[model samples]
Target: MIQPIFVYGQHILEQPCTDIQLESPQLQNLVNNLWDTMRNAQGCGLSAPQIGLPYNVFVIDSQNAFQAIGKGFRKRYFDAEDKGIQGIFINPQLLEVSSKMWKAEEGCLSLPSLIKGVSRPWQIKISYYNEQLEYRIQEFSGLTARMILHELDHTNGILLINHMGLLIKKYLYFKLKSIKKGRVKVSYPISTR
Candidate 1:
């Protein structure tokens, strides 16, 4: 079932999420809901906190974002093996990050109509459990790494706005206020509590 995303200003969005038990009965359902809600909202990634759940989980399907770009674009930044990854990350940890950095504009499901430039490591080493409850440590780079870092921030109670400088936040003050007031417009469902 598709769940309504909890928008910015919701207290849950600010609180850090808790780790999930591998044996939790509702784990599968939660992962499914994350995927369903993300796809419904046409977002490449969705975190458990986005749906009012405080579990340390997130789902990503970078293929959808890749499909939107042209072949030339893909060839420039991606390798032949970079078809994209689709999976659920549970109890994830950012093991390491490369010194190299990349900056890009990112929009979040919890912050509709807001896009901001954020800088993140160009590559990252992460340890996480898949939906099957299998643990794995892997390295990711390019757009995949960017998406992972964005969702990871959610699990840590961090928002894209936190990356903004004082000036940018001042400029977006009213817009953020509107979102917190539940006045922003979006195609998918949203909850402000």
Candidate 2:
């Protein structure tokens, strides 16, 4: 199912999610929903919280972003059998985010019709349980890393708005207000509650 994104001003976006059992049928459904919602929105990632589930789970498929990484993206990450490196990451814990920072204009399904400049680490190291309950530690860079960091923030109840300074927030006040009031037009479905 293509689940609706829980937009800004929603309490779920502010409340940290809890980890769940690895083998639950509901967890499988949530993962499927995340993938579907992300693809429908043309987004590189989606978190459980974004779909109104307070579970520490997120799905990332930045490898699908052919333009961002060029046409050879699959070649870079795919194996001989064409199995690409991307999927649901559960119970994610940020092991480290590099001190080096990169600034970019980021858009979120949670903050539709809006794009904000935010600074994030250029690289990250994280540990998490995969959908198969396999514990893994991984490092990533480029937009892949940025997307993971962004989705990881969702699991911790942190919004991209929280990363902005007061001045920027003030500058975007009207746009943000429009979103909260459900007046902004978004291509994808969103829930402000």
**lDDT per residue as tens, model 2, 33-151:** 99999999888889998999999999988656633554565454323343334778999888988988878778888888677777888778999998788999988776677788899
| Segments in model 1 whose C-alpha atoms lie over 4 Å from true places | 75-77
> TM-score, each model?
0.96, 0.87
The regions of model 2 sitting more than 4 angstroms off are: 67-85
lDDT, residue 82, model 2: 37
RMSD to the hidden true structure, all candidates = 1.2, 3.7
Over 1-193, each residue of candidate 1 has an lDDT whose tens digit, in order, gives: 9999998888888889999999999899999999999999999999999999999999998777678789888764455778778978999999999998877789999999888877888789999998778999999888888999999999989998888899998998999999998898889989986
CA RMSD (A), model 2:
3.7
